[model samples]
Target chain A: MPKEVAIIGVGYAGFRALTPEVSYKELMYEAAVKAYEDAGVDPRRDIESFVTVAEDFTEGTSIFDEYVPDQLGAVLKPVHTISGEGLHGFIAAYLQVLTGAMDIVAVEAHSKASNILTPDEIMAFAMDPVYNRPLRANPHFIAGLEMNRYLCETGTTREQCALVVAKNKHNALYNPLAAYGASIAVEDVLESEMVSYPLSRLDMSPRADGAIVMVLAARERAEELSDIPIWIRGVGWCNDSFSLENRDWTNAIYAARAAEMAYRMAGIRTPWQELDFAEIDDTFSYKELQHMEALRLCRPGEAGLLVEDGATEIGGEFPVNPSGGSLGMGHLLDASGLARLLEVVLQLRGEAGQHQLSDVETGLAFGWRGLPTTSGAAVILSN
Target chain B: MALLEKVDKNIEARAWQGEIPIQSRYTCGLAGEKFFREIMENGRFAGTHCAECEYTYVPPTIYCERCFAKLDEWVEVGPEGTVQSFTVLLVAPDGTPLEEPDILALIQLDGADSVLVHRLGKVGLDELAIGMRVKAVFKPKKEREGSILDIVHFVPVNA
Candidate 1:
């Protein structure tokens, strides 16, 4: 049996399209201090181990792992970089906490996307250098292709996807931390600048700089530290091949397998029935729907209707992305996972005031590291 | 006044030119024995077939990622897939800069288990369709410098 892990405290330094005023280290330090205070523990003595989620290329810094410890208050503690998301980083941290390796783990993830003056140059680097690079294509091309396939397979339409941009951007209005809140209509989204076919500029998540940090401890350790402990009931992650030649663009095999493992372990036979709410990885509008189907929150190809029917609305049956998700929250890449995890804790604790669902006890969080966009993680949480 | 003119001319020169280095590493893997041998020979695309599972892999593999075991057979895949998903791009990666717009799409190859990523040509965003039939246009055998780009791009074949 996987050992139980609990979130003793969660902290967020609000996301932004560009936090030009603060240095990357400063952005992380602000969140780290809040996390320590929220957990009511000192990082110097309480944090037993640290796990950081980051990617080398995204940061434009090769040894990103080396530079994080100082800002996170781990001068010489055991730290491991998962090179992905806070959930994936926390997955490893949970193991450390449960295996009696460590009592407290500080998990952190952040992005400095705005620092890259040429966003296109950064995106172009994500392509497969040999075969993919020569094509001279924007990363949005992949989003467009996936969107087209998602529509064709699900019997959904472009207008429906436009609604996702409208709904989420509108949903951001209530979220103080959200960076892209605007009162926009479906027609407005459809009319926006086209980045790729079946996708518009508004359909995409903005590249932004932000940070999220959460402190987790063993179940017993969590109870000792805080009155409210959001137990991590299940954690599972899987990776598909990196090369585009191998991936199935229509669906996420990694998500399907990871969700199954986490759900089964959490004693959740039917995610749609058992899961109270989910903060899915919606780097693009379609991913939320794709991950919904993969999570089995809805039957295959049924997510489009789920969105169209208002089932995923903030007040709906299965409220999704009440924090406005990546579509509303900035896509801080690796930090995106922890952002979802943070929102889950907020909702379960009745702290998410504007987008709170009705008495949510069982919540699910998922993360996908967008490297040729193949890796994903699913964690089941309950208070 | 003289210094201002010199500085203004320098700013224009700085604005127009500079080469920035962009590097990335891709440690992609190949599966299966025949596929492994093809990589050792350093040329071409290979596929794996499973009669029991009835799935074929385009870039070849030692075992089925589905069933997880060793497989022996190999075959040639694409130079084609009917266009499954496509997008036209206004920019290319650092290594291969393009002055003209380019089209890239996922091709569900004729006899492969999954779609392969490739470039599409002679196509505009307006002309591209979901189910368009296209053929792989290979970089000449002499120019076939061993990569997924061996086939430069997929073009609309005369159906």
Candidate 2:
């Protein structure tokens, strides 16, 4: 049997719209220091492997991995990068520990979204050159198209989608790390400026600058370091077609397949009953509803109804995104998934002060590489 | 004792424009070559079909997604299709509004399994709806460049 992995320490810095006072390196260093202090282990001494999650286009630099080690103190160690989201980085570290090749691993992911002057242009560069790119519409229109299809196929209404924005922003009121928190009604969301048909300004996640570094270790090392270690019960990731034309826009197939793999590994037969809460991708308001159905927390077309009935609120039965999610916390790009994972860890440990749900032992966190890409990841955690 | 006690104004902030000076050339291999050639020469859209899986791919693929079988059969899809989903973009990528907002739609061609994304013209948002029949408006034969833009835009069938 493979050795079990546990997240012993978690640290983060700068959950804000912009961090012009410090560079991305400094942002990472701050998070690393907190992580090392919390884990009671130094990277130079204990960590045998290091993984950083980043995308080159988002960073505007080629071979971005070369610049990561010095800040995290992983210099001259086994360091690699995953050109995807933070959950993928955590999975990499988990695999390293499971192999017994490394006793302790450090995983880091950060987003300096403010540094990029034209994020939409960078997203466009990632699109199909001949087919999608030449149209020159805003990259976010892809979300609008998907939202329209999802709403139609699932029988979900625009009012039900607006409730997601209302709830998440309200939940963010108690979360200190949330940058875009507000207490607004569904009417306010409907009144917000329409960016694309079926999607309004309030429906989208705002960009934020932040860094998260987590310490993962085998069960043996984890026990020695921290009294409370959040065990990584299962992890799975999937990628559908690279072309948008061939994708299932009405449903998040990548998320569904990834969730199936994870649920099977975690021995979770009934996800809704077994998992306490979820932190899912709400890059757009409709996505929260879509991901819930995709993750099988609710039946198809039932996610919106569940939200409308207060089943996804903090005090509700499912209690989704009690951390405010990307909707309220502000999106951290590659770091978004880790931010969700961080909330689950804190909630599981009873360390989440104000936003903490009652009697939570297990939770799920998910991430999607935003727009025009059919890729996703899911992680299951238990206290 | 405190850090940055002696920091000056000039040293406090600096910004630079970083640019990646590189050009990329992507070749649309064997399948794309056949698909685009048909559009350019015959003014018709072609899809690759996997006989075993009975799946017809638009923006034709070299192999079947489900069966993984080689798709050697090319089938004519549509000069007309239905609007699967659509969006009205009030602003461009640079956040500036055009004189008229652009209506973009995902057109599900008549014979293809997948939808093609393109702009819609000769219709307003009120007139656009899912399942509305629309036809691709190709540019004049002389102006065709074997590109997606060769078809100027999709418009309502009656228009």
Candidate 3:
């Protein structure tokens, strides 16, 4: 059997709209210091390896991994970067410790979204240059197209999609760290200026700046360090076709495959029963509902119904995105997955102060590499 | 020693605004050359057929996604297609309102299993529907340049 890995320490800084005072490096240093302190390990000695999740395009720097070492106190040590989601970085760290090559590893991810002046242009740059870019429409239109298909095929409604925005933004009201927390209604969401048909501006999660650092260790080392270590039961990631010409528009096949791999590894047959709650990707409102079905938390088209029944509310049976998700906390670029994972750890550790769910044990966190890409990662964590 | 204090004002912070000085050229690789050349020369849609998968791909690829078979069978796809999905763009990526709301659709040409992302013209958002029959409207042959823009837009066949 593979050795188990657990997150013994987690730290984060600035889930806010802007942070002009401190640079991205300072953001990393602040979060790293707290995470190392929380785990009671000195980075130079106890931490054996480092993994960071970043995209050079978002960072406006080439080979962003070079700039991370100094801030993370990982200078000259074994360090690498995963260009995908932060949870993917977690999996890399987890596998490293499982290999027994490293007893302790630190995983870091952050968003300096405020630094990027043209967010949409950056997203548009990710499209197929020869084919899609020449058309020159906003990238969010892809989400809108998918939303139209998902709603049409699944019989989900625009009102149901709006409920997701209302629920997550309301849930964010309880999270002090959340950036865009607000108490709004579904009708308000529907009334927001339409960016694309069936997708109003409110349906999309705004950008936020933040950093998160997590320290993982082998079970033996984890138990020695902390009384309550959040065990990583399973982790899975997948990528569907990158081409828009041939890809599933209605279903998130990538999320389903990722979730399947995670569920099989964690030996979870019926996810809605085995897992207490989830922090699903809510980059767009419809995405939350689409991902719920993809995660097998509900049947196709039933995710919107679950929201209607309050089954996904903080006090509800499944309680997804109680930490306000990316919608409430602000989409943290590449760090978004780490933010989701951090909430799971906090809830599992009973550190989620106000919005904490009762008697929760197992929780899930998921991430999608935002628009125009079908890359996704899923992880199951238990206290 | 104390830590460095924070910079408070936007005027006080020193920063430079410049874009990366790099130009990139991407080749569509094995299949794209044939696909675009056919469009440039004939103003007709061409797709590659995979015998194993028994599916034709528009904006054809050299390899079959499902069976990993080398796809070289060229077939005439369509000047006619069906709308698979569509969206009306109200704003540009820079958050500027478009001159007119552009209707973009993913169209599955009659002979191909895969879809092509393109614009729809001469149709209102209310009139457009998934599965609506549409036909490609190419630019005048004199202006054809082996690019996707060679086809001006797709329009509802009935209209």
lDDT values, one for every candidate = 0.77, 0.90, 0.91
DockQ winner: 3
Q: Candidate 2 residues B72-143, lDDT tens each?
A: 898899989999999887767876555678888999899988899999999977898888999998888888
Please, what are the lDDT tens digits per residue for candidate 1 over residues B1-159? 001122234234322223458555655554533443453354445788876788887756667777886867877766556888777654344423346666777887788876777778877667788889888666656665455556667788863
DockQ of every candidate structure: 0.28, 0.54, 0.61
Q: Model 3: iRMSD?
A: 2.3
Mind giving the per-residue lDDT tens digits that candidate 2 earns over A80-188? Answer: 9999879988999999999889999999999999999878888878889988887888877898888998998999998999999999999999999999999999999
lDDT of 3 by residue, A247-338 (tens): 88878999999999999999999999999999999999999999999999999999999999999999998999999999999999989989
- List of clashing residue pairs for candidate 1: A136-B92, B31-B61, B31-B62, B32-B61, B32-B62, B79-B136
Question: What TM-scores do the predictions have?
Answer: 0.87, 0.97, 0.98
Best-performing candidate as measured by TM-score = 3
**Angstrom error at residue B43, model 3:** 1.6
Sorted into a CAPRI-style docking class, model 2 comes out as medium
Please write out the lDDT profile of model 3 over residues B57-148, one tens digit for every residue.
Answer: 98988889989988889999988999999999899879787878988899999999999999999997779898899999998888988788
Docking class of 3: medium
